[model samples]
Target: MSETFVDLGFVTAPSGVVVLGMAGWIDYWREVGEPLSVRAGVAAKAGGGYLREEECEAVAVPAAADRPLAVRATTEPSMFDEEPTIATLEIELGLPWPEGVDGPVLLGDLPVDRSGMVIGDGVGLDAWTGQEDEPADGLGDVTFWGRYEEDAHARFGGERIPHPGGVDGVYGWLDVPMAEAVALEAEISTWRGGVWGQGVAGSVEPHVDYFRFRRAGLHHPLNVGAIEVGGCQVLGIDWCQGDHSVRHHGGRDWGQAFPVTLEADGTGGTVLRWTIPPYDEDEEG
Candidate 1:
């Protein structure tokens, strides 16, 4: 059996850095009976105020090239009252061990491989806010934010996938069978959201998290050889802390599939093209 490698890309909003968690902040604001606006600012003395912490752990598996890699992370709340903070992250790919190279080099704690290496740079956060004073469905003025990195440069054994405009949220490619790809697309298309019980809050008002699919409209799925691709417009809403909320609304078109190709040894797989947005306004039907 020969070796196989798949190219993957991921993007998400940078974690929020705050002195208090969302629940605590909302409670404090309610106690004061006022709305609050917080932003990240430079601190003169680092030891006194609350310090926000974000940590992410990811593992790349050579065997599972067909499914998205699961990443686990945690962000700690600030200990003291202070300005909000933000942290930037850089994602890199670890290559295989070289043919003649003697030793190894570490890419963040993971040992490098010999296949090849490529890095995606300038991936960061983007925020979206709802209309001022207009609460949707009686929730509250909402703000939704996440990460977007432009021009992800991905290469697997000399094959490349370039994101010229930009890639939103998190995206990647795996070399699974056609049936598995279709199943994955269906799972993503039907996701509505979930509920968070008092485990994080403790009150009867459970945090309601939901996203309305086909909010903009539905885009049908496509089957091309070994690849299956599909996506639709989505409006995601999260209501916590009694009335505070966040929403993610975006438009997606049926046309245009971001193409990805995987190669290992001397064998190549069918190019898988998946739909992504920031859609072209002119191309929307």
Candidate 2:
């Protein structure tokens, strides 16, 4: 078993305009008897392309450390679109790992909390892998099975959004050691029309390389899709949010509906089951 530590920080303009918040987690594969240490900082790159270091203040202590991660001093937002400025959170491992340890690994999912922004209501995780010092130009080597957020629901001005459901956190793990030459890739497609895997009121052709995973996990939440896993074809769906109902429309007369649940079988496997409800006639498409 491995131990993981998560670090979170935020940066904003002096006026409190949020630049970005970052959350990073590292996994320790080897057993270390001593406590681990972490240090964090921030850097800024203005629209003019000049990089500058900034002062940071810690607001919250990390899970593994007594000190807070560093945050950047707020700066003015760019006046023009072309001059977009960037604030980057910098985190470093304060102590060395034991020999034969594979990580201090960082995921591309920064887990930023940019609430109230027009960029929609959620953060997205990217699939990529590389050494901390190496450029990330190649495809990811890990299998990203899926991600979920917790406590992601938000309210604006005392009114809940039409769709208030969102995830606040994600959980995943490495299924296998990564090979340097392997790249993350996957395909996605959809089928609409006629029910029961038959009849075609509409059809969606295959989308090559539409999605990729660094590892294998239950990723898709709404519909059944097939992907090649371990050289075998597997179908999976995920409704990660609890108490949420999903409707599957197949043609005009046939459809499937269910509430999803994720269960662990206690043998390092996850079981996904759908509590399908009886068909409802009043539901609008």
Candidate 3:
């Protein structure tokens, strides 16, 4: 259970830890819903990136070190400036997808222009440095569940949604076409306020550290905030369009949403899930 497709390239600092450079290359914009065709210079190395050499069409890596895991971050928007924010850090990858496919929808492709794609870091830029020194615990009791974008409905509740479309948390992939049977729906956004359970890092730990500084999914996606003063760093995108279905809610606790079972695996690819929730808590003091 270890698929591979390496093009080699990875670097995520600011403490969210996502660095894998025996080489380099990281330009993400691969969605698959209604924006299908994104594959921006995806290359990661150190041992095996590019999903470990495509792993038979899509099995990236990590088939049984756990499950379907290959989470990523650094959704570039020039990092960030003022409005449009979301992306503190997240990497919950168990890995698995491409073995008799079953309702696999996660797509996004309609924005391609990879500036030559060469996110270099041969140990140079300090590996895309970002850890100021430890000091980011703003979002107090964080919790922003899921299921939201029907049309967004103005982000419901307390409307303040900004960034890409202000819907929060989402990646890309989904274009099913063979033996089809898809039904993938993910509109669960969360980042409740107050620097919630802060823990920015860059991982490669002990050989592999599936960092779960819980405050969101492991249990911490409820209004997290705190940490501002010239803050800037937001990048969250999610989309899934037409025919999709997946089912595997048998063991990893899918009570509060976390059950993947994508079924249609061909001309229907789209299930983008990009996240970076760490809303700045200062700036205006």
Model 3 local distance difference test score = 0.21
lDDT, candidate 3, 138-192, per-residue tens? 1112122224323233443222222222246322222222122111111222222
lDDT tens digits, residue span 183-212, model 2 = 211110012222333321211111111222
Clashes per candidate, residues 3 or more apart or on different chains: 14, 15, 136
TM-score on alpha carbons, each prediction: 0.16, 0.17, 0.17
The predicted structure with the larger TM-score, 1 or 3, is 3
List candidate 2 stretches off by more than 4 Å. 1-64, 72-84, 92-98, 102-104, 108-285
Cα misplacement distance, residue 226 of candidate 2 (Å): 46
Q: Write the per-residue lDDT of candidate 1 for residues 108-223, one digit (tens) a residue.
A: 22111111111111111012112221222333111111121111112111112211111221232323343444444334323322123211101111111111111111121110
Residue 142 error, candidate 2, Å: 48
- Local accuracy by lDDT, each model: 0.19, 0.21, 0.21
